[model samples]
Structures are given as structure tokens and as C-alpha cells.
Target: MTASKTLNVGDKAPDFHLPDAEGRMISLSDYRGVPVVVYFYPKDDTPGCTAEACAFRDQYEDFKQVGAEVIGISSDAPDRHARFAGKHRLPFVLLSDQDGAVRKAYGVAATFGILPGRVTFVIDRDGVIGHIFSSQFRATRHVSEAIDVLGRLA
Candidate 1:
């Protein structure tokens, strides 16, 4: 399949419907009129991923205060996401993008064509992307960067 074009600031965020850890369907349109932070990570329970998730968990209230919803996506199954979220007490939704369809739609390129890319997108209430941050090695920074942009949007 052809790679999807990379997303950029000011572009409309792609809408998607995916299952959360509990297997309940979630749609991007469901979050319309509120800012959303969508982050794609490589795997569940990995060191960097854990750190990144915890960082987001710790600051979840801040995001809520700004009226933004945070969502994490990975190729992991819903059961794996459930375990990961439970293990870390993550307060946000962890989505199962098992086939990486949403990942490709967001243009999250895999690292070296092996590991999945770590990228975060902050979409404004109007559905336009406000910021896009990608850094496979600096996973935790994704949380901070997204929050920073949300602060501006707020």
C-alpha cells in the first residue's frame, strides 16, 4: 500500500473509529468540539513507552483542565492495551490499532522500517492539527510537547 501523506499543523485531523482497551468503539468525531491529543507509540509495556504513558498519566488532570482528551494508540491488541493501562494506572484511553491502519492514516512512519514511530498530534476543537511532534527516542517529551501546545490553544 502507498504510504499516507504526513500530517502537518493547520491540516484537518483525520477522523477514525477504533476500539479502546475495553473493546468499546471510539470515534474521533465523538471528541469534536474539544481538543484532543492523539499519540502513537511503538509497543505496550516497553521502557520508553511506559515512561511516556506515565508522564501523560501524571499530567492527565492538567489536560482535562484544559478540556483536552488524551488518547494513546499502538498496534497492540485491546487486551494488551488493557493490561498496559491497568499496570500503569493510565487515566486516558489506550486504543488498539492492531492493523496500523490509523497509524498510516496519520502518517506515523516506522523507524528504520522496523519499529513503529512515536508521534503525537494535538488537534484543536475545530479538528485542525495544532501541533505534531515525532521522536522515537524521546518518547516522554511527546507528553510535554502536546501539553505545551494545548496550553497555547487554551
Candidate 2:
């Protein structure tokens, strides 16, 4: 399910407070003053989601080198996120959007009938969205798109 409004480049990325894999509440406001790559995927351990996540994990250090943060969000519960992150050894944060309020706020819609949409937003240090990438099939492209935005921002 998506919202009536879809966020666009230069719009302020919507703020959200969701739980991470460890049940720790994390808010977008907390990452203020840093560029953030926020990605929304369908599920925890699915094929495409896993590929997208691992791609982010692989490039995590490069993001850090440029002073950016990476976060992944899904409707899965905290425990499921924990297991998925542990199994994949994902170094970045994975937040549980259990009620999917965050996804709705970001206007990430359902794709291919029921699968949740795959979207990535690169928010600059000022909190304005610098880039938006949406592709349900080409999952890994989200990471590269965000990285390119952050690279330019850096």
C-alpha cells in the first residue's frame, strides 16, 4: 500500500521512528547532518532483497568513507530482521516496519500484485532527498544509484 503523495527529489524525506533488528527505536532525525541511503524492500530474506542487501553491505565501507549512513527497511518483524541480518552478515541497519507506516509515508507501493515496492532514497545532509530509485526487478541498482548520489554529495 502507498500513500496518495509520492516523494520526489528535493522534498524533505519523511521522518520515521522504527525498530531495528534488536528492537531499538531509530528515527530518521537521529541521522541528521549526514547523508542517508534509505532503502525499502519487500521481505527479509528473499532473493532480490538479499541481493540488494548484500550489495549494500559490500559497499558499506565505501559509504562510511564518504560519511554516509545506510539503512534498510521492511515490513518484517524485528526478530526476522535480526535473523536475516545475522545470516547475511549485513553490517548496516535493518529496521522493522512491522505496521508499514514508514513505507506508506515514503509512498512505496505494492509491486507485481502483492510484493512491496523496492525503493531507495538518498537524502542529503540537509534532509532533502537528493535521489530516488524505484525498481522491483533490478534490485541492486538501488544501491548503485544511492552511492552515486552520495558520491556526488560528498
Q: Which predicted model would earn the best TM-score?
A: 1
- List residue ranges in candidate 1 displaced over 4 A: 1-3
Query: What's model 1's TM-score?
Result: 0.97
lDDT of 1 by residue, 1-154 (tens): 2358878999998888899999999988899999999999999999999999999999999999999999999999999999999999999999998888899999999999999999999999999999999999999899899989999889
On residues 66-136, what C-alpha lDDT tens digit does candidate 2 reach at each position? 99999999999999999999999999999988887889889889997698999999998889999999999
lDDT of each: 0.93, 0.91
**Cα RMSDs of all predictions?**
1.4, 1.7
Native-referenced Cα lDDT, model 1:
0.93
Flag clash pairs in model 2: none
Clashes of each: 0, 0
